[model samples]
Target: MTRGTVILKNGKVFIALGYSNSDSYPSGEIGQMLVKALSNSSDEETVQIIRELIGGLQKDEFSKDCMESLREIGEAFYNKKAATKVGLDDVYGYYYDYSYVYDIKTRKLQIFHFGQLEYSFKKEDFPFLRLVVENDELLYTLSYDTKNKCFKGIDAEVKKVKRMKKAGKSPQYILEIAKSLSERIHYVVDEVYSSDCWPNAVQKGVTFYPSRKRLKFIFKENYGKWNVYIQLPWVRQGLIHNCTSRKAAMNKLIAYLDGNWESFQSGMDLYELYEDCQQKLMNFYNACDQISITKDEFNESVGQIEKEFRGKLIPLEELDYSGWTKAFGPDRAKKEIANWIFMTHRHIFDCIQKA
Candidate 1:
C-alpha cells in the first residue's frame, strides 16, 4: 500500500499529501514541516489550528492512530506557545482518547476524556499536564518532550483508553443537586415571607440576601456537599454550615431564620419594658391573696419574681427609683417589695452597660 503524509502545522493538518490509498502515514518531512510551522506560527494561529483539528477529529474523518498523531502535534504546539501567551485559545473538538480546549478569553481549560468532559481548570491555577498525570495517577500520560515527533507510548495509551472506555462513566449528580437546592431555596423563601414582605423584608432570586442590610445567605457546592453561609456586614469570615445534602441545608436555613425572628421580637420588647413591668407587677399582686407569710418565704418569692424582670430593665434605667425607696421607707413589707424591684432593675442595667 502507498503511504500518506499528513502535514500538521501548529495544531492543524495544514496539508494531507498522498499518491494513493495508504495503510500507514509517513513522518520524516511532514513532522519536520509541522515542527517548523508550529515554531514560526503566532499563538492565535496555533489556537485556530487546534480548533480546526479538533473539529475534524469530531467529524471522524481520521482513524484512531491518525487522531493520536494529531493530538501529539496539538500538544507540541501548546507547549511552545504556553509560556509566552497570556491569553490562550479555547479549542473545541471531539474526544478520541482525550482532548483539551484552553479558552483564550476566560483563560479556562476544559478536558475531555472517555467521550465526556472530565475536568476544567484555570490557566496557571493548576499544575502542568505531565505533573497532573503523574500526581493524580491518570490513565493516559502526557509527554513533555517537544522534540520527539512521533507519538510516544501509543500502544500503552491506546490500551489504557480502551480499558477506560470499558469502565462505565460516572454520572455528574452535582448539577442536579445544585438545581434542586436552588429551587428549594426559592420555594422556602417564598413560603416563609408574606407577599407584603417580598422585595422589602426579604428578596429572593438567583440568591437570597437581606434587602435592608449587606447580609447574605449564600449556598455553594464544596467537594460533593452543599455549604451554607451567612455573610454578615464587615465580616471577612462568615458563619458556615456544611451540609451533606440539600435537605440539611434547607433545614439549617429555616432554623437560622426562626432564631433571627425570635431575636428581633425580643429586641422590640425591650422598648416596651416599662409598660410590661407594670402589667406583670399588677398581675402578680392581684393574684396574691391577703394572707400571713414568713419573711424568708416572701424573700424567696421575690427572688423568683425578679427573674422575669432581668432583661426588661433597658427602658427603666433612666427612671427615678429614689421616689419608690422614699415612699416605702420604714415599712418592712413595702420595703421588701421595693428592694426586689430595685435590685432586679439595677442588675440588668449593669449587665447592659458592661456589654
Candidate 2:
C-alpha cells in the first residue's frame, strides 16, 4: 500500500494510507484506511494498533492484508516516538508518510495523488488564476472552506470536451484539465476568503467568491476609493483530469486561458506590487558599468534593513496587505485606483494601435 503524509506550511495535515492497483493495494482501500486513521485524534497509538493488525494479515484474509498494510504504515509513525512517553512540548506530531496535504494556515495547497490526482490555487487579490502543473496533471478542480472546513466539488461536464479529440493526444488533454482545475481552485479560495468586492456588505474584511462566468474585470467603489476585483472557482479532488471529457470548445478555451491568463491579469494591473518594485528598482547607471539591482538583491536589502530597524519594509508577506497601505499612505483606500487607471489606459493604447 502507498502511505504518505502531506504537511502544509500551515499546520493543517493530511495523512494518507491506501493501496493502488498499480502499487501496494487498491487505491480506494488505501484512501479509506487513511481517512480512518486521520479521524482518530490519537494517531500515535493508532499506528501501533494498525501495525499489529497488518502483522496478522495472512491465511487468505483480504481484510487482514489491507489492515496489515495500514498498520505497517501506522507503526512506522508510532515507533518514531512513543506517544504516551513523549511530553506535549517534546512531542512531534505526524504518522506515516503523507504525500499531499493542504495547509490553510499557510495558504498553500499540496497534493500527492498517485498520478491520478492534480491540483491548483487562486489568490484573493488577482484578476487571473494560477494552476499548479509541476508534478501531477490536473483534470478537475477542488475547493475547501476555511471557516466551516468543508470541500466544494464541481461536476464539470467532460464527456463532450472537444479539445482532447482535436489535439488527438491523452497527455495534452490531461494537462489541459490540470490547468482548468487550478483556475477553479483559485476561484474557490477567493470566495471563502474575499467574499464580495472590497466593500462586501456582509463580511467586513477582504472577501473572495467563485463565479461560473468568465472574470468580468470591474472596478468597485468603496470607502471613497475604487477597488478592482475578479471571481473564480475551486477544483474538487479526483475529478481534476475530467476536463478532457468536457465539451471541445470550452476545454480549448480553458487550456488557452490557463497559459495566458497571467498576462491578461498583468494587463489589468493585478501585479501592482511587482510593478512598483520594478519601477522603484535601483540601478547603477554609471558612465561605463550599468548594473541592474535584481529583485532578489532588492528583497535581500529590504530584509536586512528591516531586521536592523525592527520594522519590515517589504509588505507582501504581511497578512494585512500593509505594502499597499504604506505605499499609498493617506490614499491607501484608493491604492488600486492608480492600477485601474494604468490598466485602462494601456487597453486604450492597444486598441488605438490596432486601429
CA deviation > 4 Å runs, candidate 2 = 1-355
Which prediction has the highest lDDT against the true structure? 1
- Compose the digit string of candidate 2's lDDT tens values, residues 1-355: 4454322222423233222222222133333333343344553543543443333333245434544543444322222333334342134344333233333344333333332222222122111112122211133233222221122243332321212333334544545654564454432222322244434321122212232323332234444433332221111111112232223323343343444443333222323333343233212112112334544554465444324322222342333322121332213313333344345434433443444
Cα-based lDDT at residue 307, candidate 1:
53
Each model's TM-score?
0.18, 0.23
Off by over 4 Å in 1: 1-60, 63-95, 126-128, 134-355
Candidate 1 vs. true structure, TM-score? 0.18
Model 1: ten consecutive residues of lowest lDDT: 140-149
